[model samples]
Target: MTALVEMKDLKKTYKMGETYVKALDGINLTIKKDEFVSIVGPSGSGKSTLMNMIGCLDALDEGTYFLEGTDVSELSSSKLALIRSKKIGFIFQGFNLLSKLTALENVEMPLIYQNYSHKNRKKKAIEALEKVGLGDRLHHKPTELSGGQQQRVAIARALVADPPIILADEPTGNLDSKSGKEIMDMLVDLHKQGNTIILITHDTYIANTARRKIVLKDGKITEDVEVS
Candidate 1:
């Protein structure tokens, strides 16, 4: 299988007046197409930093990152933005939905960036919502839905673009056990449909749900193992 994401000698640093902090230090990793992988680490372990690099949300100080065979680290800002819009979908722990927009409208937001026609955006958004089992909640606002439902809407928004890779950051952090399980199940179903899924979380049990686990500590990967 082709590598969906590839990082080599990745390094990120932040200046703190007198000293510098390494968010990611000499990290190398690869995630292949249609693989479900989890990145687990304690707080400040640089997992989030790695996610930012993989998602093309931030630039690294050193190393090369290739997304779908394109060297993203060398791309211009405009090109990077285009890659983000077209190649990656992000799911956040906070559910990141606008309070005022209905679920359907929220899902349609990404399509607007792609300059899709209104009718086409609505059609794609409806299909995404239905795929996540939110067909009946399309008209409801985020506040009107439960925590799980709101997250479902977020998932719908992520999938609406039909991106090849899904990057989820702490996707189940705020939900109850039942809801978290449901969300994980939904993600598993998505992986089964041939999407590459990279999940970032601090929870071991949650990380185990993926077929492969990468453990990070102090800006380095300490373990990369395949689960049964």
Candidate 2:
């Protein structure tokens, strides 16, 4: 089967005055459909750069990227936006929720962009919130919920689109241990349900939870290991 995501000799560099900083250097990777993978590294290790590349949020300076068999590096900006909307769901550590919107409303925001009918959007939002165990809290705002509950709202929003790939960056970084574990369990369940997940974190324990772990150092992949 073709890989869900493929990168070959990917490189990204940033210019700071007269110096050029390499964010990602010659990264080659393949993530299969429905596979749970984690990219872990410390600061300046290029984890974020790799995630940005895979998520189609940034264009690399060199190399090629194929998403679900299409060469994304060759796509236009408008096409890239369409592909991102259609293929990827993003979950961030900060919970990126609008302060004034209720959980249901926030989850419905993505559907709004997709031009979903109001009634259908509500139905899907409710189902997604419920999936994250927040059925009773749909009416609450982000400030009204606990940290874990807030993250759950973010997860619900990510799932609301039913995208094939879920990209979570430092998903548990802001939560307490109990809450972090809960979030991890939810991710594991989502993986079992056949959603391809790519997690980015600096935590070894968190990285180990995935079936495959890719370690990065100094903008290069240092190790790629599959756990049994």
Candidate 3:
């Protein structure tokens, strides 16, 4: 199977005054299409930095990153933005929804960026919400929903674009145990439907849900373990 993502000798460094902070030392990994993988580590382990690069939210200082066979390091900011908007979907621990928008509207926002017609955007947003089992709450505001439900809306927003890669950053971090499990189950369901998932979490239990685990420590991959 062709890999959906490949990073070779990826490195990211930040400058603070005269000192350079290495966020990612050298990460080499391949994620196949439709696979579920997790980046696992303790705090300040560079896992989040790796996620930032993968999501196109940040750039690497050195090495090559290929997303669906396209080199990203050489891409201009505009091109990178296009790729990020069209090919990657992001989920955050906080759900990041506009408090004023309803779930349907929140999901529709990404479609607007893609220039979808109003009818199609609404249709797609509803479909995405249903996929995450939130069809009935389409008109509800994020504030009206439970933590898990708001995150479901976030997932819906991510799915509305139908991006090839779904990059989730500790999606269940703020939820209660039951809700966290439910969210994980939803992710598994999406994975089963052939979505490539890249989940980042510090929790071992959450990380173990993925078939493959990449553990990071001190800005480097300490182990790449396959659990399934």
What is candidate 1's lDDT per residue for 139-190, written digit by digit as tens?
9999999999999999989899999999999999999999999999999999
Q: Deviation in angstroms for 18 in model 2? A: 2.6
Worst 10 residues of 2 by lDDT: 78-87
Q: Give the local distance difference test score of model 1.
A: 0.93
In candidate 1, which residue ranges exceed 4 Å CA deviation?
A: none
- Residue lDDT tens for model 3, 44-75: 89888899999988988999999999999889
TM-score for each model: 0.97, 0.97, 0.97
lDDT of 2 by residue, 1-228 (tens): 999899999999989899999999999999999999999999999999899999999998999999999999989998888788778899998989999999999999988888899999999999999999999998999999999999999998989999989999999999999999999999999999989999999999999999999999999999999976
lDDT of 1 at 79: 88
Between prediction 1 and prediction 3, which has the larger lDDT? 1
The number of the candidate with the highest lDDT is 2
RMSD of each: 1.0, 1.0, 1.1
Native-referenced Cα lDDT, model 2:
0.94
Sum up the clashes in candidate 2: 0
The per-residue C-alpha lDDT of model 2 at residue 108 equals: 96
Estimate the TM-score for candidate 3: 0.97
